[model samples]
Target: MLRSSLAIATVTATLIATGLPAAACGEEDKPASEKVRVSGAPGAVKNVKAVGNVPDAQGAIAMGFLQYGHRDVMAVSGEFGLKVYDLTKNPAAPKLIGEVSLPGLWETEDTEVDVKRKLVFLARDPRAYGGTTQTGESGIYIIDLKNPEKPAILSYTKVPAGHTTSCVDDCRYLWTGGPAKAANQPADWGGRPIWVTDIRDPRNPKTAPDPIELARNDGKTDYVHDVQVDDEGVAWVSGRGGVRGYWTSGYHRDPVQGKVRRATAFSPVPYAGGGIEETAAPSKFMHNSFHPSGHRSADGADSNRWRGRDLIYATEESFLDGCVGDGVLTISSLQNSYNGEGWRSTPEKPFRLKSVGTWSVAGQEGSDPTTGDCSAHYFDVRGKVLVQSFYTQGTRFLDVSDPTDPKQIAYFRPADASAWAPYWHKGYVYVADNTRGIDILKLTA
Candidate 1:
């Protein structure tokens, strides 16, 4: 929880000392060279358990989870629309909690729980107009998850949302980013227009007038795709453009721009992988991508204090995935960039991760040979790992003795889309897929 305060304090100090524009603040030192992924066969995750089965599930899309109260039971979330599953019966087969319908076609969703306040918050496009995947959704829907079996709609606050959000700050404020363009004009579609709502009163949550919008996402092709808020409530927001963009990450092209650039790469891109030919950020500049990280589950062992640690991890994706997640299919700049580079810097917290290098399984041409998704991440300090599902790339584990440079200790992936994010508790990782439903893997690694 204090991590956010530290980040903010650090930023404030840097701004004051260097007097440099956030854009000019260069070289965040702390082992930028350690983009490593150690390999260890976490054995075959034969453990199988079903949380709940939803019919016509295009994708399981289990993106977020929360454990509330002294028992600190786990509740999971998915889909851009309405989906609330109850995993209280067992960590594996979560019974049908309840589903609250969204008014319109909503996408780019995330959820959070205020165990202290007994409220659940899920964010999505408010679907005010007839839902169309073209026009993105922009709002946060409030759900009260007091009764795990029966979660009902408590309130709804219409807000802009480009990607997802981090709810570790206070559970009272459901924060999200997505610039609401001039209505029908989809200019700043999903950019950094960070909006925070105060949900102190579960029944009547109100939107706090003052919301923080990231400067970069606001002007360009708006798209604050994802965020990770620390315990101090300082949200680290990120995004990609629908067309073209300019950020501290430098100017980037969307699918539309990439195709144009590639056509002229031979004529324009002076160098090979390191030049315009490598359109992305030039692998040299951006060390990583896919804002991929998660909230360090420092309390999986002690349900009484789930919000103890102040860390969040998220993978980075410049544009959108074509075959996987739906809605506003923005093309990827990862391939077109300066040789497929990702994040501009390494993990902010170095002491948190081990210095193990990537395994031999790493891909040759930035293909992320490991599981397929290049990175499989989670929250594991006191023995807990959270993961992000990358299509066929399965789930991965990290020995979070150090939070920043996570050690790729173990992983499990199917050859198909059935493998998704894994939730760990009591030494078990709950792996769920659309077709596979849910499978609980007891950690033997």
Candidate 2:
């Protein structure tokens, strides 16, 4: 976490020293080198066009979706606060139905939505409003989305972890995690861990005193970034160490504790996961991940490739000097990672998941070699196609049917593109960019 922060700060300082406009949320004046560029194969992804766009939607970091009045509604959060858009009438052009402008709501990269409860959890980073990580307020804003036209803030519950809040167990509770360690935290902590919050009562949420998923980074307590719950109700926690899965509910045999205990949101039982192989991901920081549970291989040649396997598609995010040192998409198999290997893993005896495959936009057909903001951010999967956002690299559509060798079927990277996260809703791809806002794109092929 410190490495990423240092690199970003150095880049910003250099840009300012050279009188160059620092690339941020709403910086309009860009250099000549920052021109629009796009690339894709003919058959892989055809007819890639921007159907609609929110040009002024700068600082757009993350997006969430919910249903209100039987219509698809999108809630986007960033430095400009949260904006709710109606995606029903026009999937391409979203109409801003409601908004909560907080000017400096920093880093809610993956917003959580409770569709059944009509609530949106806006994660508040400790570094929000030009505050330092050592001493800043961190928590979650429970926003009521009952009326899409008039979204209201139900409550702001304070928690130790708040870079991203994920709804687990049918939105009954939330697993809040990361930014960096605060001043009052333990001295040996690498970064923040996951804190459980009881959100059953939306207006009166309470955070657990203890944190889960501790000592994740090779026996050291590191930063826990985001949580993704799969179809089987397994909460996948991704961060500095690697990606790990836990059972948040039900009575299950605890692999770590070695007993049959009832798993709750606050006390989750480790299911599987471990450190990602260093070769596949040099940077220990994992941004986010997706698990293809019960998903069969789409490849006809090797139909049984992923039939009985638990594969995790993760992103190793890091902002280094060049693209090579940056993050990449890694396909890791959790075959032998079960039994709390990641929890008990130590530096002397490290436990790593098997790396099935890896992919990156670095040295690709249409990538800028000079751009430094090329780390992988967030991604979404739909059958064989995996759409991901690679910061300045734009959005990439990969054919993940063959997990071992993921091929880029299509991509959309403009000159000034700062694509943060890409989501697949309905039949189109919605890209949330820090500089370009929301871009609605459709594939012709």
Candidate 3:
């Protein structure tokens, strides 16, 4: 049964308190003994070891960062709210310095950070704190990160969409998106779309009346999961249909509308991207994406085939009957996907991008076949290396130098692992796990 992350958390907490097996939480379908016993890749990936772990601090979800003086501090958001840790003293073992107690803060998957403004945006899902979609409060909590040791909530700005909040236009604005439709939502909508919020003045953040990135799922306005801004200032929205990129800043030639227009946060111009092919990902839901070339190379570069932001590395999140049927890491080429093909796509006349490659951990090395919660979740890339989290399947390290065929170079999955998101910080990879807290890993291969 594919349950929401919050519902799983609520059930898991109850199961754990009553001394019941956590396998019944609808996350891990197998017993702990049947899960992966080892913690690191021995032969497949050499020298990749778990250096440090914060086991007691369970219910950890996603990780973000904030600037503390000259050091880059780590901020974790999960069932315990948000906590700031100093990794300077020991990169492997982070020291907890400050924290804000948001006990039931649910589903802030990709925590957004404004390094320059010293702020953190925590998106509150409607299902947070045992609330239903009909009456649950959905909004954003602007946390002042100026004082890392004592973080304070600046304000709670309400918005229609709140599954994840992403900083747009250098944190001047925000694009918040969803879990499901709230009360009195559009009848034609399958799920929630994105809502723009003006946070230029962080204290008094104002939300736009309307939403952006409409009709994302094959012409149907569906669930917009998360937003990731590329290095070129183009914000990519991922959800039920696929991944789409929009220019949020300067004047650009709108490929879809075929005109030059100045793009704003609220009114973005279609740049590139569309839906992923069904062959690569049967489930069209793209949890998130990362454009490797967006940060380094120019568009249409001839040096490398995958460079020039021509390809998008995305994670298809799905929980099926078995781990083999779950989501996989998909590498899609944005060759002919531009010109608003995704926006123009319909159920009968669908337009999907060409998938170059795909990777899964179902029958991979050091995998536990019994574990059912094996869908790929959040991932982080560094150079040619990409580290991804797959719930009970663990943290996987892949070499994406060849974008068409991503090969697993290393892996770290303990017996009681429920890795949510893996982040590459400094030289170590920090994994925020639901069962285990923060597991710091080092890759020597």
Comparing candidate 1 with candidate 3, which one achieves the higher lDDT?
Answer: 3
Q: Can you write out model 1's per-residue Cα lDDT over 167-192, one digit (the tens) per residue?
A: 53355455565433334544434323
Model 3: weakest 10-residue lDDT segment is 24-33
Stretches > 4 Å off in candidate 1: 1-58, 63-73, 80-89, 101-105, 126-137, 179-192, 208-211, 217-222, 240-314, 318-388, 399-407, 418-420, 432-435
Candidate 3, residues 35-114, lDDT tens digits: the string is 33323322233458889998755778788876667686888887678888887777777888898897777767798789
Error of 2 at 315 (Å): 0.3
Can you give the lDDT of residue 394 in candidate 2?
83
**Cα lDDT over the full model 1:** 0.36
Which regions of candidate 3 are displaced past 4 Å? 1-46, 294-309
- Candidate 2 accuracy as TM-score: 0.89
Please give me the total number of clashing residue pairs in predicted model 1. Answer: 57
Tell me, by TM-score, which candidate is best: 2
Candidate 2, which ten residues in sequence have the lowest lDDT sum? Answer: 24-33
